[model samples]
Target: MERPTRIGVQLAPQHAPMQATIDAARRLEDMGVDAVFGWDHFFPLSGDPEGVHFESTTQLAAWAVATERVQIGPLVFCNSYRNPDLLADVARTIDHISGGRFVFGIGSGWFERDYIDYGYDFGTVGTRLDALAEALPRIRARWDQLNPPPLGRMPILIGGKGERKTLPLVARHGDIWHSFVGPDELSQKLDVLRGHCEAIGRDVAEIEISNGASVRDGIGGVGFERLDALHAAGTRLLTIPLSGDDGPDGYALDRVPAFLEWRDRKNG
Candidate 1:
């Protein structure tokens, strides 16, 4: 059966107070978004480099308690930030906290400033991907051994577009594969991912395809036309980012109702 289309809003944690970020998550949930996300980074990814930011997992835990229906997670947790075993335990705890509403979205670390500021090794891209590859299995193993297992089978969402190493890792482990590419690039990448899945004897369709939509350029900013194109290209999950800097009332959700309407129309 074809999966229903889903919409998510990423409440970017940069330049916002913790309360504002929490409020944004709650509001997104109220707006009928399928999931709410924050990014794992110590500093801002845009605008002022020295903007206010909160820790990702900690904020996610807060959101887990603040909202009842929405799935919560970091858009992609930096694998290099915490020990893999510890990370699994953290995810498990949050899973229980949210009553099985946590999605474990992770990726190989990027952003040199985060590593240097936090004292983690800012190694080469190859090294980071290797570390992520090694860490994923250990995380799963630790989850298996934890005294109280996760409240449910936690879905693992891997974000990246590297065909050689990343796609293979996704084929082996990911429940969802996320990327920030347009339709043409997404089509090519999906083909590559399918090859990896075939090589591993896994069904490519088992992994949900997720893509990031720019609020300033895609569906939210442009119209439903871009969304229709993405839907036809096999994307099941579409995520739009909301920055904290947008307003004092929290992230601007003016575009969400329309997006939700579009989602319902598409799914129906």
Candidate 2:
């Protein structure tokens, strides 16, 4: 039998007070969403470039205590931000904090401002992906050596749609593959991922597929509907990102009901 489809939400880091962000996550968990995600980036991705934004891992630690039940993770952590070993250690710590309810979502670094301001080398895309490729095994190795092992083997989530480098890396290391493109694009990518899995001798079904939901008018769009299409296409995990710092006017909370309604229907 097919697993019931799952719904995940990316609570965007920009524009909200920290406590409000925590509150929102709790509310989502209360409403029975499958997972709650936050992205890893030092700077804002949209809205005012200089707007207030929360950092990923710190907020993840907060989420560990703030909510129970929902799996929590960075939608994709920038592998360039921390050394691979350190990233693994941090993930392990959060795993313990959440009593193993953690997914280590990661990807090659992007966002030039994060690099330049933080004094990390901002290399070309090829170089960054090369770094990530090197880091994956090292991170896994270090996780094994930690004095106290993680509660369960924490799942690794690899985000991105890069065919040659990213998908192959996903094939080798990921438990979940996250991408933002639509169904048709997702179908093609999955084919590529499957081929990579075959090359590596890994069963394609071992990896979960997830995508970002597109929102419009605070009511709907491809966000939830894509779950059905993605499910039909063998992509069961779905994520919708809410720009958390949308101000006291509570624009971000407006979408919660739609998410809840969709989830309730799925559960029903």
Candidate 3:
């Protein structure tokens, strides 16, 4: 079955007060966004490196309590940061808190600075991917073993563009696949992902495709032309990242209504 077109706002929890981050999530939910996301990192990914930042999972828990609707999760949690079993328990707790509105988005660890500063081993990409591969099944197993399981079958979102290791993992486990590439690149990656699905005897179409909107351009400037291409390329979930510089009012979400109109038109 085809998934409905959905829009998500990633309120990046960097260079902003914790209250602002929480407020932005509420506002995004009010604006009718399907999901709200925060990044998994100790420090800012852009701008001043040592800027104000909130931890992703904790912020997600806060968002669960603060918002009545809108799914919440990290854009992609670093698998290396926590034990898989513990992460599963944390995810389950949040799922219950949200009444089943949580998406578990995870990835192989990147950003060497996060690992180094947080005292984790800054391993090679291969090693990190290996760790992620090991973690997914363990997380699933732990979820089953929990006293109270998640409210529903929790959706797993895997973010990356690796054709070899990552796509295969997505084929086996991912309910949603997120990538930061344009239409042509996404189409190419989709083809590669399909091959991986074929290898595993899984249906590629079962995974929803999610793409990131350019933060530099803002959602309005991305234009319907680009959105059309992305929709054609199999992207049903479009996510825009709001930076801390969007001002103290929180997340300059004026463009969201237009995006919603576009999504409605496309989905229709």
Predicted candidate 2, C-alpha RMSD: 2.1
RMSD of each: 1.4, 2.1, 1.5
lDDT tens readout by residue for model 1, 65-166: 999999999899999999999999999999999999999999998899999988999999999999999999999999999989998789999999999899
Please say which candidate is ahead in lDDT: 1 or 2.
Answer: 1
Report the candidate with higher TM-score, 1 versus 2: 1
Local error of candidate 2 at residue 191 (angstroms): 1.1
TM-score of each: 0.97, 0.93, 0.96
Candidate 3, pairs of clashing residues: none
**Candidate 3 ranges with C-alpha deviation above 4 Å:** 216-222
lDDT: which candidate is best?
Answer: 1
lDDT of each model, Cα atoms only?
Answer: 0.90, 0.84, 0.89
Sort all candidates by TM-score, best to worst. Answer: 1, 3, 2
Per-residue CA lDDT of candidate 2, range 16-76, in tens? 7788778888988987788999998887898888888888999999999998799999988
lDDT of 2 at 58: 92
Global CA lDDT of candidate 2, please?
Answer: 0.84
